[model samples]
Target: MSVLIETTAGNITLDLFVESQPLPCFNFLKLCKLNYYFFTPFHTIDKDFSVHCGNPNYPNPPNIISSSIIEDTQFQDQSLSPYLLAPKSTIKPTLGTFSFVKSIHENQQVFDSRFIITLSDSFDDSLENQVIPFGQIIEGFTVLETINNTPIESIELKRPLRDIRITYIHILHDPFPDPNNFHPYPLEPSEFQLSTMRFPELSKTTKDINSDNNNEYNALTLELVGDLPHYSIKPSPETLFVAKLNPITTSESLEIVFGRFGNVKNVNIILEPKTKKSLCYGFVEYNEQHEAESAYRKLSKGCVIDGRKLHIDFSQSVR
Candidate 1:
């Protein structure tokens, strides 16, 4: 079976190994037919490494074509069925090779919804038993490279500067006749909820800011404290410290405000852990240092956010 992924970066065609990896290939094909990949962002882009996607929680939910895919069967049983053949004993993950991401539970590893495509020649012996390489990209290597080279806001998390979203997935071919026969149990509620997650629309001001702020920021912060011979690292200049947020301000609002400066890598709102209430402060990271500086200067000059003047500065914490 084969599928064509139309992403903001470009189109990539993947050939599935249905004979060798029936369960994963079948599930992937089914998801494609149901338009499960629409608008899903490629959350991780590690240059010279790999680009990761299929995350249901990064920006928003998958565009589910049918609730049946979510209600039909449990992913764990289908993925780990004894009837299914084991993955190849060894995998040489070259560029364009596709594989599933695994989640660790105690000593056991379970399949996660996320998947990755290698961007370089590399292999992981430990992943041979855990991750299943069900497909290989047959086209659009350049698109993958473009995604890998996209500016990033966080090197540690490998988040893209701007969301490279999957526009849609078109199933070109599928040989499976009785894919439903492989079902085991009903999908868990949490899994279904995750597949249907949604987020509010970004504000116009935020959109305008992201469009205008295009310069890349790459400055590193070095701190030298008195009596200390070694210099300590501070947060990247691309990261902004935000304070005096309205108590009722939401993470979405914070994102819209700071996101104007540049592509927001991440936004963290300090909260009362137990109550999950906003503590009226947060941090926002941009892809470039100039973006953060612009936000700091503009917002510090006293921008009213939800009726409160926001305090912005460079964060002291290291990235």
Candidate 2:
């Protein structure tokens, strides 16, 4: 069953499995119908294997769902036991997983919503039924990937972490977060945590980088790793990557309007981190080198944004 899970960035379509694990599936579906999963999160995220959501608390889980630290996937002579509430293994978690920690006694049964999803791909054996793949992501994986790449400094752990935030969720017949309000987080989490979309160029080496923005104009560069927001990996062009224009003229709008005239490959808006403002400029990446020149000659004049005539041109060299 595919259901629409809307996020602030966009809507992620999901395919729910009703048969694999009935209890968790029912719980998940119930939460969906009741909107109990609204404004929740899949906090434990792995870019390679999976992304996990489903903490009990609004922002955090009250207690880990699996109380008893039982065996997960390593038990020998194990028959495919079909019905259990929590996971009974120690294996590292994977994507699309909804495994609950289980107990050795089988009496200490507990289950909450702590779950994960697989962002890491290209592994055959890693995701071998270890995690219960209850539902699949449809639309918002890109946005979700962006979130997974966000770098967060763990003041507590004294390390960095992937920025995972859930702004809203609609679960059925489950307990809603707000007793007063009818719906969950209507605004998307990304709207609140904008910085998390792209991986920070400056990895969290020290606390001051996160605290102070105006440290120095260090060129932000990083090793390509973990949840990349989008496939933005082309080398910076020799020409500058901005198009000066008035406010209200968006990069997307320009791409749509001008790209039709010729073989324009792509459009990009360069944004300033602190200000969150586009630098009043854009990039028109054409499919062929010649197409860019021709389009620049033809369409660079009288571009209108917010009724303001704009100047379109090649940007500074990106090195």
Q: How many clashes in each structure?
A: 2, 51
Alpha-carbon TM-score of each model against the true structure: 0.50, 0.39
* lDDT per residue as tens, model 1, 1-319: 2765666555576878777776667667766655555556676677887788885456543323222242254433343354256555244667898887655545665454568888887656655665668788866676787787888877787777555666555555677543434432221213333233222232343344432342210010001111112223333778876766788988889889778878999998766544666656667989888888888877877788899877666764442
- After the best TM-score superposition of candidate 2, give how far the Cα of residue 244 lies from its true spot, in angstroms: 40
TM-score of 1: 0.50
lDDT of each candidate versus the true structure = 0.61, 0.45
Residue 9 error, candidate 2, Å? 3.7
Worst lDDT window (10 residues) for model 2?
67-76
Which prediction has the highest lDDT against the true structure? 1
Regions of model 1 farther than 4 Å from truth:
59-83, 86-89, 105-108, 124-130, 178-204, 207-319
The C-alpha RMSD in Å for every predicted model, in order, reads 21.3, 16.6
